[model samples]
Target chain A: MIRVRDLTIRVGSFALEGVSFTVAAGRYAVLMGKTGSGKSTLLEAITGLRPIEAGSVELLGRDVTRLKPADRGVGYVPQDLALFPTMTVREHLAFAQAIRGWDRTPTEQRVAELADLLGIDHLLDRQPQGLSGGEAQRTALGRALSFRPRVLLLDEPLSALDEETREGMYDLLRTVHRETGVTVLHVTHSLTEAKKLGDCIFRLADGKIGEMA
Target chain B: MSSRRRGTTPSTGRSDVPFLVALGVMGGFYVLLIVGMLVADVLSTTPGHLWALLKNRDIRYSIKLSLISCTITAILSVWVAVPLGYLLSRYQFRGKALLDVLLDIPIVLPPLVIGLCLLILFSTPPGRGVQQFVQVTYAIPSVIIAQFAVAAAFAVRTMRVAFDQISPRQEQVALTLGCSRSQAFWRVVLPQARQGVLTAGTVAWARAMGEFGPVLVFSGTTRGYTEVLPTTVFLELSTYSLEGAVAVSVLMVIVALVVLLIVRVYGMGSAPVGGR
Candidate 1:
């Protein structure tokens, strides 16, 4: 479970004031808001990328507010998927393992497993440059799962995809959530996605969580 | 011959008429100069003396010294510049523009002024802070310092631009994957900027290797000590060793050509990946 209490942050010309929410374990919690509604900022604040002026974040009943982003055990999939361009897909898989100081063999196996699960096994040899929208998102998802993060944060993951691909990705994401049982905090402006996938909906306006459904 | 026709207009269908005309004028001059130089160098190469000049001790020392010091500068410059470049590119902090401008100062200064400044700063007791601390004055170390000053400036500028071209979104995704900031940087960001880094390093090293004025002032023009290729050429030309000087010139040209060819090959291989 993840609990965020009274989170506040001030960026240039934008501010989030006293935002708070709770996402139950294995539950899909979607934050719905229009552009510049602090939906992304809330995610960033929870991940420690943005400085919270006043707040406390609790993950699995542990106070993670003071912890660095690396120590949070939280997976963040930015809107763009941020795969390293210099590496082949295979090398990126290896790097995911290498970063955690995990064994090389197990890392390879896990990469294979994730690739298979995400339907990107064939693209393992390719670079991010050649990846299609769906493929890139899958690879990004695979990279996030390699470390077995306790919670996954998705920032408008479906927005960049075409209509067809976005629908496919939504289905894939639903299946992945069911199989993995990871806590998901998905941010989106689309009310339809919120109604379809969210077990609970939190409406954010002017950087505050107004109400929950 | 029955139905073929050709005109001054380009047939490839890119028709920015004014831009193409401007590009043609500049490009034409550049091509003409290069072709003229290549022809001249080829025509001037006499077999008998070219072989004999290679045997000279001073010539050999100049070539050897130039390669060694410039290489050292390149290595050091890249070592420091990579991290600095990445930081500057990725982070928003106080005084960023000032820091950038300071790093770029070496590139804007005249090479002769740089040498003069090095001479003053490393010369004696009062202004010898660097010499006292590191003891690189009037030696190969001074030459390295001079080369590093310029080379690092070039590298930082190149890498900064390269890193800017890459979106920060890539590393942010890695961070969400439980990777540390450094891990994300090494795995995602650095690899993405690899070609830019390579191109920058190549340009920096080439610039350093061909540097003459600053190196001469800082390292001195002593034979087998600080006498790099250009300095040796100057010494030879001054002392009326005209053939020897020409031979050194020919050697410099050859080395430069080889480096250019290597950069071209590497660049071509890497170019396609960054386009997308």
Candidate 2:
């Protein structure tokens, strides 16, 4: 479960005041806002990439506001899918587990398992540059979900895909949510996507988060 | 109304001849200067005479010292540049701007002034304290130190550009993936910077090979000891050995060309990681 209360953050002249939201455990929530609406800033604050002025962030019932990003155990896939270009798809899947000191055998097993689940087993040896939009999306999603974090935060994950790829991704995302039961807070500007996937929708405008009727 | 077919190719209707000629003229001047100087050097002597000069013990010693010193300088430069460059590129501290300017001092300062400053620096108690262990003035170590003083600046600049080109988002993503900051940098960032490291090493080596003024002033052009290629050029010119000077300069140019070619080919091999 992810809960943020009275979160406030400022960047230059832009400000987000009293932004509050929650995603119940095992629920897929979508946060929607138009471009330049400080959606990324708020998401970054929760990810510990940006400092918050006044707020409390609780992840899996533990207050993570003062913790480092690595300590938060939160999986984040940015808008650009910031996949390390030098690493193969298998390496990306193994990255988080390896960081936690997992041995090569178990790590390889887990990587193979995730690659099979994400349907990227055939492309495991390929770098990200060779992957298609849906392939890359699945790769990023697999990487994020590899460590089995309780909360998965996606920042505009499908904004850069074509219609066909986005449609396939919608199904993939739903499968991921159902299979893992990880709390997901997906940020996007598309209501169509929200209605397609979100169990609850939160809207951000005028520097505040509100529920859509 | 006359209807004309649109061209399939993306070209302007008229050739940009006059504009292109203007650019060619300005750029051709420097190209002419370099080619003209090389032509004159080749014309000054035959290949045999240049080859014979390499037979001289002192000249051979100068070539060996130049190669060794330049390589050492390059290694030392990269060792300092990588950390300093990463620090400058990824962080914003209170005195960062000032530190940046300070780093550029060797690049911008007159070589003679830098040598003089080193001379004065060594005269101080701390320098003497260091000298008590091993002499640094007018010695073999002084030659490498003098070359490093300037060449490291160039390496640092190249490394800073390299680090700047990579997105911090990669490291941030690594952190979210469970790596600590240092782990993220070492595992993800540094491996991708291999091309930059090669480029910086080449630049530092070339600069060290051509560094003359500080080595001349501080190391004193002692033959077979501190006389690198650049100072050897000066020694040849002072002794009216035009053939020697031209030949050494040509040799330096050839070494530089080979190193740059190696770097460019290797750089092309690893170009994919040059982006985010």
Candidate 3:
């Protein structure tokens, strides 16, 4: 479960004012917002990338408002996917495990499992440059899932894909959620994407979060 | 197949031809001037004379000292440049513009002025305190310090550009993937910066190797002591050994070309990886 209570963040002239939201455990929650609605900013605040001016971020029933990003145990896949260009697909998947001090055998097994789960095993040796949009998204998903964080923060992870590819990714994302039972907070402007994937939908507007009917 | 057309196009309608030709001639003349001098030196000096100059103990010592000191200066410059450049690139703070201008002073100021400033600093209380612990002025260490004063500015400039080119998004993603801030920097940012660092190092080394004014003023170009290649050229020229000076200049040119070649090769190999 993830809970953000009255989270307010200011970045230069833009501000997210007293925004709050909650996603039940294991639910695929979609956050709908227009451009410049502070969707990405809110996600960054949750991940501790952006400092909250007020209020708190709680993850899995723990107060992690002041925790460092690495200590927050939140997996984030930004809009760009932001893959490390120098690293191979395998390295990308293994990075979180290595950083979190996972044991080698289990880590390898987890990487293999994620590769299989994401259907990126064939692209394991390739770097980000060689990957297609769908493949890169899969690799990013695999990387986010590598550490098995309690919540996954997806910032328009499928926005760059074509219609066909986006459909595939939506299915893939839903399947992954059902299989792993990990909570997801997916941010997007696409109403269709929300209707198709969200167990719970929250609309973000005017720097506030309101649960949809 | 198109040779006839290619040969006639410039003469037919290209009004820029005259301007291009004039520009080319001026560029060629400037290059030829330097090349012609080097050629003239080569023609006048015999193999025996070059060998003797190379074998001179003072020249040999100066060459060795230049290589060692320049290499150290290059390493130290990059060592300082990386973190400093990252800070300058990624952060906004009060007096940042002033700090940037301060970093650039060594690059723009007359080298002798920098040497004078160092001399003045070392004579002060804090400078004397440092000198009491370790010799600086008129010492070999001063050669490196002087070189570093200018070379580090160049390195910092190169590294700032490098860090500026990398998106902070990559580092953020690394942090989200369980890397601490330092971990993200080392794993993500540093690897991307490797080519820039190498380029900065070589450029700094080349600059340090060729630096004369600061070394002369601050370190003192004493033979078998603090003399380096550029200082050796000065000493040789003062003694009316034009051949010896040209030889040293040629050696410096060769070293610079080799470093540049390495940088080119490195840049080529890493270009694809850094495309992001």
DockQ of each: 0.47, 0.68, 0.56
**Cα distance off (Å), candidate 2, residue B253:** 1.7
**What is the per-residue lDDT of model 3 for residues B1-276, given as tens digits with 9 covering 90 to 100?**
656565454465558888999999989998999899878766766767767877989888887898899899999999999998999999999999999999999999999999999999899999999999999999999999999999999999999999998999999988888788899999989988887888889889989988988999999978999999899889989999887888877766666678678778977787656355
lDDT of 1 by residue, B115-134 (tens): 88878776767657666767
**Best model per TM-score:** 2
RMSD of each: 5.6, 2.6, 5.2
How well is each residue in A3-86 modelled by candidate 1, as lDDT tens digits? 999887889878887777889889989989989888888888888777788989999888999988878888788887777766
Look at candidate 1 and give me any clashing residue pairs. Answer: A76-B176, A82-B170, A84-B188, A86-B191, A86-B192
> How many pairs collide in each candidate, listed in order?
5, 0, 0
Which pairs of residues collide in candidate 2?
none
Q: In candidate 3 chain A, what residue range of length 10 has the lowest lDDT sum? A: A17-26
Off by over 4 Å in 2: B1-12, B16-22, B270-276
| TM-scores for every candidate against the unseen true structure | 0.88, 0.95, 0.90
Q: Which stretches of candidate 3 lie over 4 Å from their true place?
A: B1-49, B266-274
lDDT of 3 at A26: 89
lDDT of candidate 3 vs native?
0.90
Q: Is candidate 1 or candidate 3 better by DockQ?
A: 3
- Fnat, model 1, is 0.62
Model 1, which residues run further than 4 Å from truth?
A90-95, B1-18, B93-95, B125-137, B240-244, B267-272
Candidate rank order under lDDT: 3, 2, 1
